[model samples]
Structure formats: C-alpha cells, structure tokens
Target: MDLLPLAVSSVIFLLVSVFLYSWKLNSSGTKLPPGPRGLPILGYLPFLDRNLHLQFTILARKYGPIYRLWLGSKLCIVVSSPSLIKQVVRDQDTVFANRDPTIAALLGTGGVDIITSPYGPYWSNLRKLFASEMLSHANLDASYVLRRNEVRRAIRNVQEKIGTGVDIGELIFVTELNVVMSLLWGGTFEGEKRDRIGAEFREKVSKFIELLEKPNLSDFFPVLARFDFQGIAKEMKDLLPSFDEILDYVINDRLKIMDSEQVEGELPSAKRGKDFVQILLDLKEQNVAEESMTLTQIKVLLVYSTTIT
Candidate 1:
C-alpha cells in the first residue's frame, strides 16, 4: 500500500550495502581507536551537541584521548588531552603534518589561504619565502611605527568613550582589528566605515571559524562527502568575493607603490612605515627571478600571508 516508503527504504539499503562493500574491500585490518556506537545513516550525529568542542571533550573523556565519532556517514578521529596532543604535535609531528584538501580548506577560509593549505612542496616554498621576506625581524621592526601610531589612535578612541557605557567587547575587537588592519592595509578606518568594515570582517572570520571547527559528515564519509548537507559550499561561494576584494585592495596599493619610482628610504617622513605588502611585493620579484612564479601563485601567496597574520 505504501510503495513510496518502500522504495525509499530499498534505495537506502542499496547505498548502505555499496558503502559496506567498498569499506570491506579497502579497509586494512588495522583497528581504529574506540568510539561511541553509531547508528545507520545518521551515525553518531544525533548524539553530538551543537557545541562541538564540548561534545568531543566529553567523548574524549569516556573513550580515551583518541576516539572516533561519526557525523552522518563520516567517521572523524578526535584527538584530545594534553599528553596525546603533545605526542602528535611533537613526537609524530611529520607523520601527522599534512594540510587538509583544497575543498576542505576553502570551506574554512572562503578561499585558498595559507594557514589551512595542505602541506606540500608549493606550500613549503611559499611559507619559507614569506618567513624570510615578510615576517623577518627586520621587516617587523620596519612596521613598528605603523603599530605605534595605530595603538595611539586606539587609545584615543577608548578615551573618548570612557563614560559613554560603550560595549567593551566591541571596543576591544575594534582596537585589535585596527592594529591588524594598519599592519596589513596601512590605515585604520574612521567614522561609519570603521564600524562597517570591523563588523563585516568579524562576521566573516566568525563564520570561517565556525565552518572549520564543525564536523562535516562529508569529511568523514567518503561515499557521501560530495553532498554538502550543511550548505558550507554555498557559504564559501558567497564569502569569497568579499575576501578577494579586500585582497585586491592590498595588492593594488602595493603595486602602486612599486610603480612609483620612490625608494623605501626616501619615503616622506609621514609615509615612512613599511608594511607587509611591501615585503610581499619584494618576495614576488625574487620568486620571479628564481622560479617562474605565475600571477595566480603570487596572489595566492599574498592571500595566504594576509590570512595568517
């Protein structure tokens, strides 16, 4: 009588059978760490709390430091506790040291930023170039003047709001954000623009963090990983353009400086502070001479550098 439900059940049974067959074929005899029991289709997803960290921590306590949890069809290995963390981070560092795939990183970064990028020859080279060029001690020292000025401005803003019963959380976020923005973009926002950019960046960063920390069913269940049940892919597509616009502004401003025949030391007293952008541009030139760096690679490096710091 209920042929629709029967049909749906048949399809689900077929999928599960296929998945089990594949698992049996490829899975090694090596045993995974203990974990909570998972149900069909949903796995352990229904058991998980909305706050992933707390949920995992509870499981870690019960199941030991290393335990697996299923989010939908995917099985995720959660590593917790200080001792296990140290063992992975220090002892077996290399074996555990690999970046997640591009799609996974993109879900968290809104683009291919450096921090979430997988460990590879290209990533290694780009990281080294950034370290030696942009984040070097001399470069950081050069940018100190920018930091000082921005800090002073932040203090002044706080002073003005001393008795206005301002939101401490908002104030602190804006102050820290301005310091970072000045280091990266060479100026702080003011008036309405300040509030807007600060709010926008905060929201974007929060979303990115949320996406990264949450367990995706697709990430664990290779068979169903293609289906983005959480709408993570849609969110990434929407967020990337705004991120690109910010990056474009940084890159274009640096290029304008390079096009001007002005030497760094000869910069006016007011514009003397050299920021990360200048350092990255110089690295880009070096990369061109040593290896044929493409435009996309250069842009990727810049995007990565900005995201990390």
Candidate 2:
C-alpha cells in the first residue's frame, strides 16, 4: 500500500510537470529568430569568441542581420542593420524595454536603480524623476563650475608635466572621477581626507567594475544564481560593505551639515545651487505620494554616479 501511494504521488508530479512545460510552449506561441542550435543549458555562451565583434559579423552573415542566440537560459536578439535597430529601439521600444540584468549588477545596486529595474510603473517613475531632477537644465547649469574647476586642475597638472610625457588618458580619468565625486558631494571631505577617501574608492571601484565585467555561470544559468556557483555575487556582496562605509560617512557628514544649516539658515555647502546628492537627499526627506525614493535607492544612486569606469 505504501508503494502504491508513492507511485500515485510520482504520477501526479509527472503530470503537473508535463502540463507546465506544455503551457510554457503554448504561451510563447510567437516564433523566435532562427540561429545556431546550442547545447542544453550552456547555450551559445561556450561557443562565443573573445574577439566577439568578428564572431558576431560572421554570425550575421550566416543568420542574417536580425537573429537570435541563446545565452544559457537567456535569449538575445541581435539587430545589426540600422533600420532593424531603429525598429527595435524606437518602434518596438515598449515591447523590449525590460532588461536581463546580471546577478552581479543586482547585488551591487539591489536591482532598484533605473538601469536594473523592470519595465513597469516604478521604472517609468524613476525615468521621470531623472529627467526632471538629475538631467534638468538647472542641475547641469549648477554643476558647470565643478566641471570647469576640474578641467582647469587637469590643465595645470598637464602643464606641470609638459615635455615629461604625461599620460593624458590617466589625467582625464582622474579628472572625470573628481568631477563626478564633486557633483555627487562637494567639499564633504576636503584636502587629505578627500584624497584618502578617493584613493580608497578607486581601489574598491576597480574590483567592483572588474566583477561587473567578469562572466559568471549564475548570469547564464539563472537557476544557479541562488547558489552563486561562480562566486561573482559573493564578491559583489563583500564589496558592498566597503562602499557602504564611504557612502555612510559622506552622507552622515552631509546630514550633520544640513542640520546645522537648517538651524543657522545657510546653504553654503553649495556654491551656486544644490548638487545632485543634495537634491536626492531633499527628495529622500519628502513624502511625495508614489514618487518618493527609499534610502536604498538614494544610496545606490550615489554609488552608481561614481561608477564612471
């Protein structure tokens, strides 16, 4: 009788699995773009060449301009022709707005920021907020002095190293990072403290970007994402605390200053107007219905701003 019960249970499970699999095929009735067949699970990931541009060109010739490739569980539709690109990006934008973000990106930013969020009301709201607040003319105008000063500093550095063969690329990278940091938070950590913090940030940022670019099995086989079989997610988690430390110090320092400013009626932290960090902080304090951002969202925004690399 026990064996009979076990057999019945097995049959029921088999029936449910078959039903679900059939339903998946039925639901996705639309045909996918034809391309090379790949192995089960790994898909085309193993077959990808390091020289991916050349490989893609070869694939384009074989599969036509617009074709598909299965990267593990993920299906990628590549559009080579400009007309196809326009059709996908402009005409069919709504149909393809959602993105398949890597597990590292999710761990790094908590999947709430604009780039990681799904195509939904939350993403739409974030876009509207970014357009009206972050990319607004007033915000860019306010950041002009920060940009000019950083460029002038770079010029001075280059001038000092004239005929010494200064690496212009390195000079530009540091200058850009400084401008991003200043725009994110101006004069929060001045002089030695600022330089020290920037150096620490650069070290962490290097590892963070490295992990972001590194290929991981989890992103390919999402069923293994929870396992983090490749350790990409764990590395990202480890990097988070370091990022949090710097962010917490700067944010708390700013909060203290803002509190003092409130008491004394001063906004001297800003030269012309509030920078991006200040504006985000202001929004964080407000209780705007359905539009208010959370602390995680705010912190993620701040960290991502410095991810120029």
lDDT of all predictions, in order shown?
0.64, 0.77
TM-score to native of every candidate shown: 0.76, 0.83
Candidate 2 per-residue lDDT over residues 1-309, each given as its tens digit: 469999999889878866654454445536866677665445678899999889988999999998878787777878888898898889999888888888889888888977889998998877766667766888778777767777898899888887798887888778988887667765566677877887887788789889989999888777887888778888899999998898788788878878988999976446544566677787677654266787677777776666741
**Tens digit of lDDT per residue, candidate 1, span 35-58?**
776665566777777787988878
lDDT for 212 (candidate 1): 60
The stretch of ten residues in a row with the least summed lDDT in candidate 2 is 20-29
Candidate closest to the true structure, highest lDDT: 2
| lDDT score of residue 26 within candidate 1 | 39
Model 1 lowest lDDT segment of ten: 261-270
